[model samples]
Target: MENQWLQVSYADLLQATDGFSSANLIGVGSFGSVYKGILECFETVVAVKVLNLLQQGAFKSLAAEWEALRNIRHRNLVKILTVCSSINFNGNDFKALVFEYMPNGSLEKWLHPNVDEQPQLRNLNLTQRLNIAIDVASASSSSFENTNHDLKPGNVLLDDDMVAHVGDFGLARFLSEAAESCSQNQTSTFGIKGSIGYIPPEYGMGGKASKYGDVYSYGILLLKMITGKRPTNDMFKDNQSLHHFAKSAFPEQVMEIIDPRLLQENAEAFLDSENHNNLKNKMRDCLVALVRVGVSCSAESPGERMEMREIAMEMHAVRDLYLEVGIQ
Candidate 1:
């Protein structure tokens, strides 16, 4: 498998990306910027994530991602095609990772489409949204069981078929048996391991990275999907957070706070039903159960959060129920 990886260098990438033109620039994050390039040797489009060597933890982030993806292979996790550790034309250190291109882009765009996106591409229906939630849970269940310190929507990429793939392991850490306890979870060099709104509360209090912290972040991500709001949305000011916002409406008013677009998409289906009232009741029940899981997982205390394995299993059951009920 090692031999199968195409050996690439700064010149190869520069040529592929036409000198890393901003037109080919796709995404940017704390550690580095990602560029869409056509690797000549592979003759395929790939995402080149070039690390910012001057950044505080750039080297550590590169090492962390490599360690996280080295032995892991999951359909829902982004595939690392190859890596380049070389020097640029100016004799500066250049490090980058090549990844399979995801044409559908990030979940963040789907949740909050930019003005430039066509109106038709703005919303994800209930079924698609549920599937994405399940995909993230499955990946987090398998991967976070070890640890992926960052688990926000922006880090979730979608393939051509819209399958969610967890990526950006720049903050990932493994939780050995010796590091599963509260004190151990506090063990880390990265100051704060995740994005705001998605970060667990404990992390703000100097807590270390842990699977439980990952669960908290996943919970917030799930809630964001359901509500169609980012954790840092302007509406979430004061003591009102995405968690409390959802929790305040759980079970009863959940249907009220759901992404209006989601309601609009399903409105026609409900209206077409001869027993529209019954269908509404069933849909409400399904949504209530999902919100319950989200609230449970995002509880203020780590001990109060649900395990990722349990979340994956529960999400599976919810998807099955959604399909079985003909809710689409």
Candidate 2:
């Protein structure tokens, strides 16, 4: 494919990233390292993804990301600002892509905050979490035709205003092309392309890339965000998946498994007798609905899983109901 993106010089990127110093490093992935930089010309903060050409699939990933992001436009999707492909100061081939900076980092950090960090920074209220879940569902529903093969918490970024943006399109593929010859019931041979715990069960059985796989991954992500537990957490051993873990808790013990910070933050409001019981019941009902949705979307059978559009709609209703209860 011809490079159609606006290209920036290596020297300029080097300067913007302060010689790619450690301090500027924001994220490290299989393809490359992403650095937070400020473009002198635009005077705007941006994320610069410097490709590690030596990595196994770095070149393909770079091209895939460009192809996936170029034509797509969504509020919840990260915007690519520009591209850079040139010889660096050492004469080595360099390729980088710039994206709009997201100041709030990612969902992973918030869901599983670093113990070493301040306690206040780790808290994500019910409203914020619900909004983020809706944002992700909206993004995935819009891109269902173009399945994001790798959907995980680490790939979901948050802007300064806390709007969730689904990103990392390196493993993205169009289901229309990949599933043309296969029937809905039949599995197609697609190499495993998603993170371990987030991958759909059928994919391990040779299922092809389809919208259902994305739904499964999104389901896992929703569960993770709700419970603050990684799908691959060590506690999930002995064939106890995150789905089962959450399912077992269901409507009653969900609060026990949920992020304590969430409960702690909302505990004060439920101190009154009559109003407190009413609000608590409303909260419980909402939690039940949320977990049910998560379970339905993450069903082991692809045919049993809910569609992205349906998931998005249900999340919106849940959020609306939660808001209606007047809980902060």
Candidate 3:
């Protein structure tokens, strides 16, 4: 039952996961399959992760994940209920992580959403969207701000309540104060992690990971939440990334890229020049701020970026102002 991290019995994991059957499988993951399970403790519904150890080096990464999850917790960070280790068949070196189940899956699934649950989009008003972004920003400010490391969307999971919890520590790192002080270093990669497209260009070039990288990634998520476009959408298909493409346009072509779902309420003059007459038109200022924030965070120069805490403050200011004026 317990260790540095809570220990989960293999049998319970197997039973709860129905022997890892397809019926119980919730989704295929990059590293393993996630199954819906119930923990013996409180009959807690949890995500049973059966990690794949195909590569010899992957075991080390798995161990790192275990250690990282055990050492930290945050409302936005996924809670690890328990883990199962060791095995009988194939060396029975089985390893698994049991986390609180998030019925809504992830923001990625929600952004593009699905036909069966299209109505759910209605629940995400401007206030709710801003709140979601704030939650993520706060979590990032807490987690990565300490380690000066960033996580990608795959690492961000949303519970049924639409509350975002930062998860997936496989790429997280603990930077010594000494290490954090160095602004520009080549081997500066914080374990060389971050999802592609979401990865800061400097990180890809083997530079350091910082709170700014997380801020940069959050900005992308903001764009996705607003436009319902993946970082790899067709708009970005011809090698023009959204950040780069949006640089020159700002509030001008903003409507061209906003999510159609969000445009429904403003149908009368969503494109009307008179639309600028409304206070929400000032949202252009927010979008402009957003573009600057994204560009800075993803800046090839890490020195140019704002820290995550600053980002959270900026969002709070923007969202507060938006709500004050009742912008539709």
lDDT of each: 0.82, 0.81, 0.65
Strongest candidate by lDDT: 1
Q: Every model's Cα RMSD, please?
A: 3.4, 3.8, 4.8
Write model 1 residue lDDT over 131-239, tens digit each, in one string: 9999998998884476555788889999999999999887545322213443533533233444767767766565656788888888899888888888888998888
Mark the regions of model 2 whose C-alpha exceeds 4 Å error after superposition. Answer: 1-6, 174-194, 272-274
What does the lDDT read for residue 165 in candidate 3?
82
**Number of the top-ranking candidate, with TM-score as the measure:** 1
- Runs with alpha carbons beyond 4 Å of true place in candidate 3: 1-6, 88-91, 114-123, 148-150, 172-194, 237-239, 266-276, 282-285
lDDT per residue (tens digit) for residues 214-258 in model 2: 898888988887787888889988888999988899867887787
Off by over 4 Å in 1: 174-194
lDDT of 3 by residue, 1-328 (tens): 5555555677778777777888888766546778998766656888987878783334555566677667677787788877777683556577887888888777666565567876555346556677777887888787436453345555667787778787765544432221444444522443332355676665544445556666667767776676666777677876577676655556577666666665565455445645556645666566556555655565555677777888889889878776655555
How does residue 325 of candidate 2 score in lDDT? Answer: 78
**Cα-based lDDT at residue 57, candidate 1:** 66
User: Candidate 2, TM-score vs. the true structure?
Assistant: 0.90
**If both were scored by lDDT, which would come out higher, candidate 1 or candidate 3?**
1
lDDT of 3 at 218: 73
Weakest ten-residue segment in model 3 by summed lDDT: 171-180
**Model 3, position 122: C-alpha lDDT score:** 36
